[model samples]
Target: MASQKIATLVLVLGLLIMPFSIASYAQIPCNTVYNDLYPCLGFVMGGGKVDPACCSGFKTVLGLAKTKTDRQGVCSCLKSLVSDATDGEIKNAAQIPKLCGLNIPYVISRNIDCSK
Candidate 1:
């Protein structure tokens, strides 16, 4: 159960690490970020097991960023979601990448600065 909660938080955190610029991401619009993230919301908000589909979506989204603008865009998006999370929640969420066997360039933390 504890692991489940952690996994849930991590999935949501992972969702905030991708870029969605249509031109850069092969026409992936920013709004569609929500579509991929939809399934993880319930788990992220309520605390439970993270879904495999959620991780799959996360992987696809994470792969979209390929430039500085992309990183900044993803960072901007991450800031909003990170704001609503508690320290513990953020810690758990940051663990998603590792849990999913992925390595991201940036660290997902509450204090993360999007401008960098």
Candidate 2:
């Protein structure tokens, strides 16, 4: 009876957790961000008004980050991109979210620790 109860409890727990696990695993691809945000590069590097497409891309990326792991994945991708960016571009990146009227939790910087 005790063994049956344990098995039933385990099955219940698994069923309860399955949907969350699936949702967590369904993060947007990192490459998708690169493709979406590509239009922002010219403005980010050149000190001009960001394009409307750039803002739309930023909104899409923000919307995809529904979990902590997803957010961290984005941070990692941003870190790599920023590493290759000019200082001016990095500055522009930091301002992009605010400029777009979006509230992102992580600052866009090469030095930001994405592990958090």
Candidate 3:
């Protein structure tokens, strides 16, 4: 009887939680995340590969700069994100706005492929 009750309770809990879980798992906009990120990266790398350690610091600084509406501060912060991201991720992220149908001429122009 105890086992049966436990099973029933588990079933009820699962059913109750399923909808919220589904809603919570909704897709995040990678383009937005990338847009928010790549500029900072460019500021960091200036024109080089990204490093992993710089990512966390970049995110934190970017968050703070964003709150204050400081473009220069945000650019300063991107220097770090750019220093941290892998070369591949940086390249991929640069392409995100275009992939999302955004006319990010400035960002796209910065890409190595864009000039070639």
Candidate 4:
């Protein structure tokens, strides 16, 4: 009975700590970026103006990227999303920061070396 109780306590402690560890591992959640930018798919595809919400979302993601690793993660996430987009769509995505009056340091492109 004591062994079972100790095992249960260990399991509970592991469960409690799991979320904090995962949260620390991924400082920026990519899903947030996807949710924020999904509204801009039409604009990115070259059919319409960027939505205010999209710009807001982009800014939020940009603000959250406070480190080099975070920035690279964002870039990698974006690259995967844009892989299926047309050349024009990719171009529009690359230009979003400029058009939105934001100042992102790196251009959004699949060709970018995220490791840097």
Off by over 4 Å in 4: 1-25
1-116: candidate 3 lDDT, tens digit per residue: 55643543354334333333211222322223334443434333343544333354335333543332243333332232233345554565555444434332244222222221
* The candidate that achieves the highest lDDT relative to the unseen native structure: 2
Q: Against the unseen true structure, what C-alpha lDDT does each candidate score?
A: 0.60, 0.70, 0.37, 0.67
Best by TM-score: 2
Reference-based TM-score, model 2:
0.74
Model 4's TM-score against the true structure: 0.72
Minimum summed lDDT over a 10-residue window in model 3 is located at 21-30
C-alpha RMSD by candidate, in order: 7.0, 17.2, 18.5, 14.0
Q: After superposition, how far is residue 4 of candidate 4 from its true place, in Å?
A: 57
Q: What value of lDDT does candidate 1 attain over all alpha carbons?
A: 0.60
TM-scores of all candidate predictions against the true structure: 0.63, 0.74, 0.28, 0.72
lDDT of 2 by residue, 18-89 (tens): 333322333755566666676676577565898888899989988888888888877776775666555766
Greater-lDDT candidate between 1 and 2: 2
Instruction: List the candidates ranked by lDDT, beginning with the highest.
Output: 2, 4, 1, 3
